[model samples]
Target chain A: MGTQLDPEYVRTLRSDFAVAHKLLSDRCLYESAKWSAEALNGLPEDEVDDPEILIPDELKQLDQMSSSERRQYMLAKACFDCREYDRAARILEHCTSSKCCFLKWYARYISGEKKREEDSEVILGPLDGDATINKQVILIIDEIEEHFRTVAAAVYDPFLLYLYGVALIKHKCDKLAFEPLTRAVNIYPFNWAAWQELGRCVQNVDQLPFVLSQIPPTHVMSKMFEVSTSQELFQSTESVFATLAQLENIFPSFLYLKIQRAMLCYHALEYDDSAKLFDHVVREDPHRLDDMDMYSNVLYVTE
Target chain B: MGTQLDPEYVRTLRSDFAVAHKLLSDRCLYESAKWSAEALNGLPEDEVDDPEILIPDELKQLDQMSSSERRQYMLAKACFDCREYDRAARILEHCTSSKCCFLKWYARYISGEKKREEDSEVILGPLDGDATINKQVILIIDEIEEHFRTVAAAVYDPFLLYLYGVALIKHKCDKLAFEPLTRAVNIYPFNWAAWQELGRCVQNVDQLPFVLSQIPPTHVMSKMFEVSTSQELFQSTESVFATLAQLENIFPSFLYLKIQRAMLCYHALEYDDSAKLFDHVVREDPHRLDDMDMYSNVLYVTE
Candidate 1:
């Protein structure tokens, strides 16, 4: 009783499905996910507004992997995409020999979070290592460093070097920390975490000039090193003012810089300027108890 | 040598771990996960840009769920959060009598993507109505409808209603689809998927007046329905022209509206206007072969 409206309509419908299937089968997960979502919503031709799908389900057919490996790979990548590096590392650790070199390295690297924390504490925690703590941390650090030298030698990932540098720094080998940290930043100038560690690894006043040259003064973390290390090196206020002046130009609104300048003002006997800067810093960051202690010390002397 | 940096500071360190353990033991997965990550990274007070933890490793602690139920709950919730709704449903399907009612309803409702697709095809696919196709699709639809009516009767979740409306639409019970969809849009107007499907369900020529009153003409979706339903209602070009004029003001760059306008022009025997509009559409969406046949018909008339 009913006639077809267009002679080629059925062929056109089949043609549409051909295009849709091709889009879904594409190996690139992000691209395939986009088209598959559009087709699934019955809007085959239009780009759907896609803020809903946050993590791209990366469970596409991977080459030459067992079922467990594939699941771990997908889960690890999903975790990494979600910024759960530690969980990703955990999944990869459980995977029965990950074929992916990056996966193998990343799993070991990030799962070292607990070890890294303990190692840092032994080096920087209270300075009373008690012999046993240092021995335990050093043994673990040695194993990690040896693994990096052997297993990660073939691949040149900046993250691995970042970990290596962090381990060395926590081992109190600041001179050895310098090499990997330098290579890391040279490879990837924007690794904020690596740069933060690099800020703390400079050995003394002489090495500060070299590290400063390597790291441009414009970086906030670079400025952070000067403030943090001044106390570490017990540098005289007069000796550090030249460097602090350059940091001041770059970080005018920096709270730590204001406090650093206040400390310098206190040391230089500029009581009024020191009082004003300390008052400003406290108002800005009241919970910075270290700054409050410094403020009290300044007030006591100035009054 | 540094004399342990005060006995209290060492105890404070141990106390911090105690607090962390207490938090993790509290069965609040999100908060516990946060502290664990913070402790792991030595970033005690900072929000780390975490890129490796997924699913909060929620299987570790569930209040009273049996092991299988706990696993399924974690997998299902993770999948849902990741927008893998179909997968979530499958996991939830295997879950042994989940105590959480919300989880049960959602798993069953949304897991029906494949069934819904097949159901929609039986209703709207090729008007053949093969006996097996109708029986299977109707069976699934009946089950979904009955479940919604009884089990989800008291709940006012917009997503649950959205599922109900979607099932009705796929079954070609557009009149029944209207109630759930109307409530769906009422509860959440920005449900674009529901709003788009709602444009297709108005019954007949006579019902347009009532639906227009129910949904204001100023609403973009209501305007969209006018264009979509013009052919179905056998609306005269004159009747819809006023509505199209209003729609043009709202959606000036809408391709479907342009094609609808072109079709109306062709029916009205305004060959010149039809040709111009179809030509514009083809240029904008150069590969729209569906419009090509219409373009050919318009060209033949115009020439």
Candidate 2:
């Protein structure tokens, strides 16, 4: 049987649980928060009796606080972190609006959450009121554009256009998303993520090369291969294998490159090279055990 | 009339021409090399007489050599660089096949170049009718594989297999191209190039993802908007504008992205944003004057 737990060790464990409880409660991870609180409440007072098993300084700090007070503090912090401004505002209602609720609410609004009437005016009031919110959004986006007008510009601030564009895209306000993303790409020709998202945006429209050419040469090649390899283009195993081989050089480090190559080799009856590359990858990475098994099955049937 | 060229200036230009000549000659960029050589020959003989010209020492040394000898030397270097081994071998026939030539020939052969019968292999010996040469080539390839394996064990080298696979595919060796590209992707999950090529390879032989996924998610949304805007997917002007607006954020600074967006916006009758982006790009980069003219035509029609 396992040795009996030390009274001091049990006390230490209970205190550590209290910190996690406070953190989770603040974040509104309610279930985890409640469970942590309960666990702390259930700690036996007898464990505190043994001097050798005394609670550590860290846990003792929480000893003075009531469970309800700790829960409220943790819950407020969590809501703020998760950008649940309304919930956070309710918890921190006694605090100044501008200091606490206002910033969080603005961040949420910018992240695409619909704003309350009070929050809406507070956030949108800074912009020219004569212009519609959509137009105001456009102006803000334009400001970002002016900042990144050169190739050397630090245009990849995730807070600026990237988040704004993502919000606009998700909202189906594509008209709004266009300028900011284009400005971002123009400022940094090497931003592949922007180029890819752009390709996805204009794929249905005529004249794809215009969008494609804007992407870096390497990214364009990769996107081309991605579109080509997907089942959207072809259905046959033979054609799939053939296409994969053509793109091998562009993505040499990819495991799929070798597996597809091995598959094609098996089909071609070039067993030697196929076996060698396959075995090499499997041996190097145990994570590919499943792939090796599947490959072996194919080889068995083909042979 | 302009003052006579400075002697020092003439010498400097001549030296610049000589360096250019050497680089071009080394690369077998024959036409450029000849131009530089001719420019050196054309330098004025008397430096003091041409005050505007400044001939450098390097150009003076080159100019002292007989034109015939220069031509011979340039031709030999060009032949060597171009891997016209027999031509190089003939020129250096009196000299035993140098170590450099042998190594060069061996490297070329391993890179898949066929060996010429007449060329002497002093260091590695004739590759033809020699099992040892084939074995050595394989060993070298294995060594390269081992080095890559040690450095980037997680990533496979798709280039070699890809090259062979592409050759096989081009030769209707579909079975061959399949495995290498598959292997390429397996090694690198984010290899978009592999994915696109794989799609193309299977397009002819299999049921494409187009049939399976049934209109990509983006296109489905586009079609919905197209219907709402009373436009066909590719036919209606509104559809074009909608598509461009959508793509703006996705491919922000891409010149082609802007052009396509502008084109689509013109079709959709959203002339303002279309013209603005177009005008901005053209105004920012006058080198795209031709594109501006095309955009202007679109604007005229849309307006």
Candidate 3:
């Protein structure tokens, strides 16, 4: 264990796992999150049994394609998967399938973001740090919003609605993002990414109930969103704790759930209890360096 | 993208994903690592098609159990999954199956680590910092070493050998760890965790060739290990870079692979090439904050 955890490489790995875990949790890929947590503790990767993803019928209709078209589609997909976004967009320029359209526009959006990361020369206002994106990125967002808006108007695909919603959110049109995101969750509530986007559009705690009414309130995903949003806004800790406890039962030893509970305890001014919970977390996952900044505060207060 | 990436919550998330990425890379779960990279870039979760894990026959014999025994086994499993390690260990005290024995001992070992994390009063040597573990943990290592030494002599389970090797390593018995870890990689070469432990036992570049000879020469895992260990010792970078480039072709846009190449370029004093690669990685994964310390160093030198 000393050989495992005391090394400089392990320290670097601990920090990296922290970031990955947060992303996995945000995506509501909790099973993957569990794998990360185990990995953080120097536990070996247990071969997991993930449910198979059914390929959409449209995607499965490759047999109907001309060989050249099939080759183009396959090549585009390969390019897209490798993050060669521009090449993927170029190859799919004339493909008329819904998947192709989504892919092309999505690639364009990502390509634009990549450009933004490279565009460090953009002058920032005195107050702005890395948050001020380049005009090129803004142009791409506008293009994404325009394309997704048109595509979503014609089709009821949940993913299309989600992209439309995300584009709107990116363009800083949260009011416009609202309906598409709601439609997205209504169509496919299990996609936590859509729910998270919807959660972002929500302005305040008072607006949450109305937003909650618009989607499937009984869904565990909605409950998760509610808990997340409420925690973000620092409201209704008691109910959030209860809901999280329920989620804990569902996702046993979920690191994110435990961290949230620990945060909730801190928020409630249960300093000793929060400290203990944080201690428990540290004990189980000693290498987890993220989220424990709050634990540090808890320790400070208790000490 | 601004709304997604600019918020304080998102800043926290970026740092978190950094840690999680490192852990996932260390575990060699690159498919899940890809998911994390996407998540960091604010990409929606794409439904993945993960291959199913085959259940070993020993674990599949649950149907042959008496109803009461089955109930007991499931209860213990539930307790174990929730991280009630002590409860799980107690529940499996009388169980005799190989799986049960592994679980029982593994739970006990984890429980010991947890206790050590909570043991805050242990005096550290002047040179020791957070690396100084409590006596309780050391005691558990001693117990684990003794248990595994006896158990491994009678069984050829790769996982058992892994645990035994880990115990010996913890007990400052790397000589003992070497054979078990070698046996582990020989028996189950795909387990990156065992390979990592084996890698730790290697003292210098001179020892690497002999170690490499013990494992499957043509296996991709072995190749990955060779690249990893070579990079760690900072020897044979030209060959290591070639291996990593081959791996990059195999796993397109693998962040860790890209980062490794960047580091290798930096090591070779190819600052311009390394800077360009780092810039590309940053653009593709704008939210990745870990491994960019080297990027910062590159920038400092270039400036």
Candidate 4:
């Protein structure tokens, strides 16, 4: 009998078992979907006809426990799937065992959900399964604080730190965003997205010199100043001239910068300087003539 | 006379100039295409009967100038458009700054068709045209060098480097392909294509430890190996094992890895080890009992 139960017996049993598993799985899936739909529609739990369909007996057994216990079970599944472990942990408030507590914490840690106490043991533990979920949650929280903090704080996870810096800049937390963003960009030099976003972040500041100094001269002269004047009116006519002088030093042969400077001069009614810069740029890079013509139209209107 | 040359005169001149330029440009473009097609097809240049459709007279005239003068002119145009400069420079071989000298050097540089130089400035010149041609040429040259160079060399241009590295790996130049591919990965980490290629490059080496070491431990033990290995016998036994190890790591609790590994082990005739790994993986991840049954059949065959 132990000699593999005979081929025919095994085959029949296998087929029967597969059929049962499939039926159970299909039923479970259908019920899960129904429950999800009812929940999404905000129907009362009692109103759920065959709510049992949504929570299979196996899963419902966990739900029969306290909310915290149900959350613990859900958290384990969530961690397995690498889904919303932080939200699951937040719902699982009463987990007390060190392993369960750390599991909840590490889920937050790895997802960049939040920063907790920097205990070395907790940080270095096997960041797999529920532990990874806690880690992700902690990372997410760290990102939130790093981005929203009035002063920049160092982040342990470089990826999360990079994201945090970008979020800060996006939310107009300029002063808070600068240092971490700068560090992130410096750390990951080949990260083009970080460089582009950091350029945008710094460009938010009023002073042109600070922006010019930070970015590559080519990118600075081409991209930053195109939108800079439009976004920020020069504090004075001389402020515009000073910015132009700094730009000219940075990009000596950049025709577009010269044209932009010329436009600024023309806007200030400094026609001679405007005409000279425009003519010089047209001679050097004749492509600038199209831009110069457009600027001239704007000049005519402004006048 | 100055007053007579007013808006009407200027407009008329502009119209006449535009027409002439368009006609000339169209003619030039057609001739260029014809020449390019001939070159690509390996047709003898002397056999072409159409004299009018040969190189443009203006370009030919520029080619007749002194070498220094031609070089200066070519450099100016190269700064604007590298493809134009390459074509123009190719025709100016008779000049002191011979077309042969510049074309050979520029082609090598643009294609990363030579060994890497330490000076970033020397390597970082105008390669901003026809990236596909550049990649193809670099890949071909890289193959030729694979026979000669005992050590792998760094490929400078990121895109061409990646293509060259991928080709090197395809030809079984694992050691030669490693550096450029690793560099490409470092440059573009999120580039899934590069990552996949890098994985392939490492896998080409027969030793499991070497191959596994190149990838992240989690990846080596997880998903990459499972997805990459085929059921075909053409795939080396070592690769199958590496893939199994990676799958086992990725889905430690999934029975699929165990089944696949068992199949591989049976094929490799390492029946016992395969059975053990498969049994352990399946037992831990009981959700895959169906797969475990299939795996047991393979084990029965091996036994």
Candidate 5:
């Protein structure tokens, strides 16, 4: 017979279950499932049937099972919930649902309690904006958005609105993006990602050209930029200017759009207009003029 | 000689001031200070004195200042608020007062709104945890902690406790760091940094040796490690175990401490004890045995 487990060890085992409950309460279902499975694995056989000892969330609802239950999604989610991300990714690959596809991508990106080797791997590379998976997700989301746009109810859904806005901005259709993202942020100010993306969409007026000019010899960003820099992204410089000007009505303090308009003028060789705009940009922050270099470039061109 | 600023330009100026006010209201003082300074720099001579235009937070309170008060700290903070990090870093170097030392360290770390040239630099190296300045700052913080520990009131101060705890952990005195950190986290649950440091301290029972062994020949971490693997850092392993055991009484579910204990035993060649501990660990989470490599090594050694 197995020697009785140390009481502290048993308490720790139970606590993992409690931690899972807390995670579940916070909607981190995958982590919760992992901890629950841990608790079960470590449970003393004598206490196995005790509800208070290790009562799972759904165990109480076991009597209410319906016959037509399609549980593959649930099983896949459970696998994810248990921190079996590799397995979850495999399960998601076979699933045709858009959520599953997103989950497949998500499983690859989001990590569990990061241990040493994984952390060292993180330390071996650059950390910012490496969410390259977002691009593919954006494409998937774009397809979803197109399908939803046809539905009357979808226009009112904030999540769908956020997705649509994100997709548009990713595709360099920022003019079409502003309304939905603004609306999404209005509905939920807590979306730091949406706020950041909205800020970018508003800032970048000629994204297609900018992306092309900025694409490194070796980039680790989204493939969206590699295949697509369509001139169609910019309807016309004047049209872009007009739309940006219209946006300034809502965000009058957004200096980025002002600079974009200046650059557009500069590119068109409207030296007087460009000079006026550059002067205003320099005037705004006379100290450490982040725009001073640009203004100098304008001067070089005009001279 | 300069023509009166265009009406639209003046309107944008006013709007920027309004934006600064909103940022200030949200307690984003740095961004607000920056925007305010921008508006001030942009203002026409007539509008420059207009209190309605870009009055920074302290402008109304300026009259209350004592005659001996120098405003270098305020000016430095203003520079920081404006996101002129490099300039702020330069300015901070000349300020020798210990009070300003923390501010100097802070300025170097919190970057300005990241622009283009810097984006490529991040991709060229590991992106995050480049807090290499932690080594230099640890010495400064050590001095601060030493002074604070003598003051009766300092123990009650959460910030002081946090600083002390952080200094201790960073200096590899993690064993002795538990008291202040535990107190700090007890006082403030939202101190994610404190919690993280606390977790690290608890987990790293034998960090110096582990780090020495784990250091990849071509690692990109700070040169501080290569310089400072001194022998005095390690005390008795039994003492560390005893202290950890004491702590686990309060934090019974500290799996990290448990793993640390198991590893310590494994290192000491107490294979029977380690095997039992490792069994519990594997039983706790069968999937993604983050310590599988070590566990296998232990098995090989034991067999």
Candidate 6:
């Protein structure tokens, strides 16, 4: 155990790590889109990070509810929260609130994925996890794709827009993913998930400048997006480095910053310098496994 | 099957629903804290909504790695991401990056939870899940409390600070939690999760003013926090309504805004008006399960 610290001491450490994390991670995901498929493949099944729904205790009093209202919103929500997506969706079939609308379709979307999972297991047995081989998944994806496309158009909700883009991409309509994803980022630029989806729509380094032009250049997210895209596309190394340096002013001693720097050195083919940076990163964060593959390559090439 | 809609249609409807959702959900959670314990209890175990870590595909090529540098970051990360918390923590034992430090301790904290879960199963058989009954959990919480207290002092990382506050609260040192939570909200006001946590530490109506004073007054999140705490404490109904009205200018037709208004009506004994608003909500979102209990109450009281 260490010395007992005062609560007052920690109160002074005030910085928006949420925004910082979003800016960094969105860019990282953008950069990873071109270079890393595994990371993208391994995301949690539910993409929407919805805030936990809180019901008032006054409402949950068992004796208070009349028998007729048994088929109520909380019932459906309880099912949804318990991961009973189909049941939740069923209960929410006629509800009209935007939250209900979003949840209904979202629950359906998840149920579709769960269906696909079960189908894949049945079809592939030991090899069943692959969605490509599971023909049943295509039908589920197509249905969800349709559901999202319809609702996304009507609601224009950022989360729905982001999901629409993802659905289009999943349905192999990568070309169609660009518009909704772009709209999502423009409307809610703070959502790294939307930005990540939009970043995936870009085909090459040549497409990046046009994509960058579409986003708000002055916005920090746009700037972060540019940096991540440039890093992935292996272009504008100097500019990207400068932007990273600027970010460093805000996020000093940030682990990802060091990794980004090391990556920049690697891209420049300054293998010795890159190796030094990697060595430093290793020393600083021995538990970090995020960029070790690059570190290994640097060592291999130098050796 | 739905009609094939053009992506151009959704492209035309660009509004920042993320901001809308945040404002609404944060308020709902605040209201829930004071009235509903079960809703709070049902939250997912790991609370920080982190962006998925994306490693470049180029970095993951297996043939490239030489044997010596095999004990790298990727291995530890793989374990961590796979939920092998103890193994990941073991691998990252000496790592020095802030991310590594955070992960190492987070892994320990989770492992402690896992241990508690197992202990609960063993001691209680059927009754083991209740943390209060488990003496072993106290030790785990105390250890984590010590670790967070020490690191939170040095790092000043917002996530760490948030966790420190949470740990302190969990350790039943509620008074000590206030300062760190306040710092967390002031620094990264955008995180509803932080606001939710801070709101939890507030014990009464009198403490609300001082807590409000500590936060940036003009910030939207501060306003949201104020509305939430006010609603939970059932104080400042008129002012809270005014704030919600102002919020409505930005998030017009948002479900939660409607819910908040209806809730205000319910609080003010405007039961008839509240019932009508809820009726509208039901008509619009028949599938919605959130806040149905309250809706049920209005019906019961009216009947």
Evaluated with lDDT, which candidate comes out highest?
Answer: 3
Question: TM-score, each model?
Answer: 0.34, 0.21, 0.45, 0.27, 0.37, 0.42
> Considering every candidate listed, which one attains the maximal TM-score?
3
Q: Tell me the tens digit of each residue's lDDT in model 5 across A122-210.
A: 44355323322233445445555655556565334433455567566655678787777666555433233444455566344454454
Local distance difference test, per candidate?
A: 0.51, 0.42, 0.60, 0.41, 0.45, 0.55
lDDT of 6 by residue, A1-303 (tens): 224433332221111222222222222222222112222211122223322223234222211322112223344444553456765676656655434544566667667767666666556467566543423335544644555556545445555566667667766778888887888777656556677777788879889878888887777567767766777676637778888766554345455666677777778888888888889878865755665888888999999
For all predictions, the C-alpha RMSD in Å is 29.9, 35.5, 15.0, 32.4, 24.7, 18.4
Candidate 2 lDDT by residue in tens digits, A1-303: 223546665556444544544333323333334334333433444413322224345323322333223223333333343344444444434432212322222234433333323234544465333222332244434433544453234424322454356446654667667665665455433233443444445534243445545544554234433433332222225546555644443333445456656655665667776787787667643333324664775556546
- Sorted on TM-score, best first, the list reads 3, 6, 5, 1, 4, 2
Please identify model 5 stretches exceeding 4 Å from their true place. A1-252, A271-303, B1-104, B107-157, B160-253, B272-303
Q: In candidate 6 chain A, what residue range of length 10 has the lowest lDDT sum?
A: A34-43
DockQ scores of the candidates = 0.01, 0.01, 0.03, 0.01, 0.03, 0.02
Listed per model, the TM-scores of chain A against the true chain A are: 0.50, 0.32, 0.68, 0.30, 0.30, 0.61
lDDT of 2 by residue, B16-37 (tens): 5455554333333333343344
**How many clashes in each structure?**
9, 94, 17, 43, 5, 23
Off by over 4 Å in 1: A1-303, B1-88, B94-155, B169-174, B190-200, B288-303
- Native-vs-model 6 lDDT? 0.55
List, residue by residue over B22-76, the lDDT tens digit for candidate 4. Answer: 2222222222222122111121112222211233343333234442343233333
Error of 4 at B67 (Å): 24
Please write out the lDDT profile of model 1 over residues A1-303, one tens digit for every residue: 223234243224223322323322221122222222222222122222222212212212113355335434543443443446555555555443313334544444444544445555446456334322333335445645665666544345555566667667766788888888878666544344566678687656787778767754454345556565674555646657767765554334445567777777776678789899999876754433434577877888878
TM-score between predicted and true chain B, model 3: 0.67
Give the per-residue Cα lDDT of candidate 1 at B297: 86
User: Residue-wise lDDT of candidate 6 within B59-130, one digit each (tens)?
Assistant: 222113222112223334435434566666776566544345445665666676677666665574575665
